[model samples]
Target: MSLLFNSYPLARSALFSLDAETAHELTLSSLQKAYDCRLTRGLMASRPEKPCRLMGLSFRNPIGLAAGLDKNGAHIDALGNLGFGFVEVGTVTPKPQPGNPKPRMFRLPRAEALINRLGFNNKGLDAFIANVRKSEWRNHGGILGLNIGKNAATPIERAVDDYLIGLEGVYPHADYVTVNISSPNTQNLRALQGQEELTGLLAPLQEKRKALADLHGRHVPMVVKIAPDLDIEQIDIIAALLPRYGVDGVIATNTTLSRESVRGLPHAGETGGLSGPPVHALSLRVIERLRGQLGIAFPIIGVGGVVSGKQAQEKTAAGANAIQLYTGLIYRGPALIGECVRALG
Candidate 1:
């Protein structure tokens, strides 16, 4: 750890002083440089044993770096060096576009959470794939899952086109591909979560998946990223439809629009999705609902508000086969990964 990162207080202070989006960019850039220098490899090499095997993929441990953290594949090796068993990059669109103007991402430090309406901002599919090709982590052999979504301007009826375009772009390089239908910032994006709508969204993607598999000469898993705000009925619909659509797994919950826990906070009024401690309960419920609907045979990647080993264990107990974190890492630092893996053991 940097002398600057020795304490969460200092790291948070250093990072919080900057604009939220800029801070994110600087943090990832710094990590990428550290990885290029091999500064964190030794720590990663000594990680504890707690391998996870789910949905035909092998993870060295259960803790993964969730999507939205490194959206353009800029820090894959750097994050891989942080001891995450897997790292999902992008929510890449067909073309690069400046997402929702300035100040779109806000940090709720007091709540150990964030509210980002970043709207899938990234360098687009082409840049993302190029960055993945240029990354140095291939030899490290950790799982790399690509999270794909449509541009905000893309209509709901045509959403599958964007997904297929993104899926095909990253198929050869990604270990798994996540179809993101849950981001709150994109208008009508979540509507694709409806049972009938989802079938429409998935059918073509499944065909494309087969075509890609044949072209690449290997099978790649496709996972659906869903919202945590859904009711039990909505969750059951997804759980039932995922396997039917030939989807490989589900990312239990994305950031939520609910403000129940952070209601009175200063940043609570910010118009963005809330993530962190407040999201844990809803995220867990979604996993539980999906488990009941789909059974243990289906794979679930539980994410949201995991800042400690106990929370990670609770997610697994709630029906997750593996887990991911973003805001938790902001509050706890890389050391949490070691603690989480040990706790999972």
Candidate 2:
């Protein structure tokens, strides 16, 4: 275990006493301050190099910090320093919006899970882009993914416009851009996952990407993030359409709304996607199924419920080209990064 994480248990206890959102804000703020003071590098152990190639980009390791944790690209440098092979930020929209409301984020500590209905709250594209450009890691060859979503107020039919705006805005600054159509919090967002809706959403983005690639002289891969609540049939439909539409990759899942595993637990009744250990099996099943459908060459970024090295390996073994962490970091701390790297290495 990394010595730097020895104090995590004590810290986790204190943070757990507060509301989930409050604890999250405090943690991010503290991390930002630590990074600003040059204290993070000393406080976290360096991750062992375990290079892997995906989406034609080389990652220092196969583990990445997942989106939603840094919704505005505000802490890329700080998060990058914690030993993630890559760091993804934002579900940023074209305009800034306050998201649901307070008490929107809840925790189920017994299940080592979280439920949130944050609604893609972020600082909009301009601020998100500015923060990305400001990151020291931006010019240092670290992989940074920009996850984009439509505004809450954007009509479901007009959602394509919001996504197109996001793609154009973040393309030059992102190593990859994730079209997040699977988030359960956004009203009618999940509707886009259906075959007809998905085709309408991705077809234009693929066309736009071609133009952007020509303009920038670089093709930034576009990956779609899906929901874990899908059945094998739905997974098959998505897997089949991805190649036809020229989509670059697929992130196996966002979070799930299923409460079967954590039923009767505190906050289980909250209306939001559930993440952490409870979703691990479901995520793995999706990856396994997607891999079967997409074949060996198509990339899949696996994320959900990976809180230890063993779970991380399970994701790769199940067919993830790379994996990401979010809820795990809340429960396990930075040590989880190194543990995963060592396991994958």
Candidate 3:
């Protein structure tokens, strides 16, 4: 733990000092290098023990690298080597498009959070899957999830089509699929959370999921990613809809629109979804609310603002079957993964 903490300040000093996007690029490149090095494979193959099962797939650990960090599936194998139990890639769209713009991603070190209106940017589905297939970077036996979303230009009425496309395309490649309807960017995207609207949108996707299962001869679980801005009734409405739609699980709370914790920080006014410590309490609230509303029958993947083992445990207690972190990964580095796993264990 001390050695892991030692690596933090140096990586933080170097990475955080750069513009947020550049820092992200540097981090990805570093993972690419580490992937090429066989960083943990030799250590693991020499003595294999880590494994976890979730959503019908076997994982190597409970700690997973969340989506948005590897938006294009570029580093699955490389990232897998870094000690994550699982890897989720992309909030991918059907077509490739440039997200908000340059300065779309911002970092608030004081809050340990990120504000990104990155708006589903990626190399599109084809390119993203190409990278994944080319990499052959399976974690020997780790779980992988494909997070799907619609393009900015897609009309809200037809969003289901895009999700179906992603589901069909990534189904053969993923352990499970995440339907991301919660991002605060893109026009009227969050409106899908409304009961009637959510049901309408999910029905077609669920139908498609079944068709894919029939085609592939296996059932693939579909989890819905939700926003944290909902009131209890709203949360209850969606919770009730999950079992009706045959959805597998829910990713409670995406980047928040609230700035309560960092109300006066320099980046406080940034027009994007906020993540990190500032989101901890509210994210946990959503998790607890959803769990309470839906009961223990459904599984929940708790994310947002988790940076320590205690925070992860809090999420687990709040009813998370598994947990993920993005901001903490940036601030605390690789060692944070080890810490969360050990603490959660």
Candidate 4:
């Protein structure tokens, strides 16, 4: 468990002084203005290109911004300025809904972790797509991945309908799409990861993907994002199912539900997925298990708690084809992006 908090200590101190979610909003708003003023590039580290090809798309570097940080695609061009080769935004739902109650996000500074129950709080698909279209990131050769999920009020049984809508809506705009099935904040959402539910979701999802591919004249890949809390048996089941159902890749894994590593730390008992350094080992284990079960050629984007360049290397070593950073970005700032990219290189 390394400290990304080490890189931008003073800035992190200031951001940490506020409530976590407020700091998040303030940071994104600040980034937008900074990018507009053409000052973001000046603050970023040297982003030497480290080209990688995966899921039939080219990435300028393997280090990407993970989904939750830009839940509506509003910060794409600005975050792209942070030296990430790619940026994935939104756990967007078909309709907009206010998420979990206030104070749903908590910080564990000593543990270098965060607990969030921010369910998929995003503007509806229409606004999300409009924001995506407004970005110049893709024109500059940055890869974009659109992450989708069901609305909180959507019944667990009819979840596939929401995902299908999300799939169809995002296909034309995304370089790739991520179907997020593992966020713990949404009630009973993890049930979608079960064998019966997964097949039900994937079959129709891929079927729609084929249809969308024909209409768009481009075969955009569909990636599944799974949780890090899975057991070996669940991993085995997922490995067998992914290729059979035509999933282009799997992001192993999402923020964890376990707080065993930070039991005594502040906010340790908060209700939400815990992300940051404490999750690094869990994420690595999931990646290794997936790689072992899925074989060498199957793509895995390892993410959970990455706080340093060497930790980034550890993910690749554990069988991640690419690595994503979010919680680390919170603690370390943009410098962490270049650090991970160079280490992966």
Steric collisions counted per model = 0, 1, 2, 0
| Tens-digit lDDT string for candidate 3 (1-345) | 334335667878978789999999998886576446654344322112346666676666788878999999988877776677778899899999998878988988888888999899898999988877775545377678889999999999999888889999999888889999999988899999999899998899889988999999988889999998888888999999998999999998798899888888888899999999888888889999988888887889999989999999999999998888788988887777777888877
lDDT of each: 0.87, 0.92, 0.84, 0.89
Whole-model alpha-carbon lDDT for candidate 3: 0.84
Candidate numbers, best TM-score first, in rank order? 2, 4, 1, 3
- For every model shown, what is its TM-score relative to the native structure? 0.96, 0.98, 0.94, 0.96
The clash number for model 3 is 2
**Which candidate leads in TM-score?**
2
Model 1, span 1-345: residue lDDT tens: 444335557766888899888988888877666666655544344345588788797888888989998889988887887778888988889999788987898888888999999988888999999999987665676889999999888888888899989999999998999999999988899999999899998999999999999999999999999999999888888888999989999998899999999989878999978999999999999999999889888999999999899999999999999999899988888878878898888
List where candidate 2 sits over 4 angstroms from the true fold: none
Candidate 4 whole-model C-alpha lDDT, 0 to 1: 0.89
329: Cα error in model 3, Å: 0.6
Off by over 4 Å in 4: 1-7, 39-46
Error of 4 at 335 (Å): 0.9
Error of 2 at 145 (Å): 0.1
Residue 25, model 3: lDDT of 91
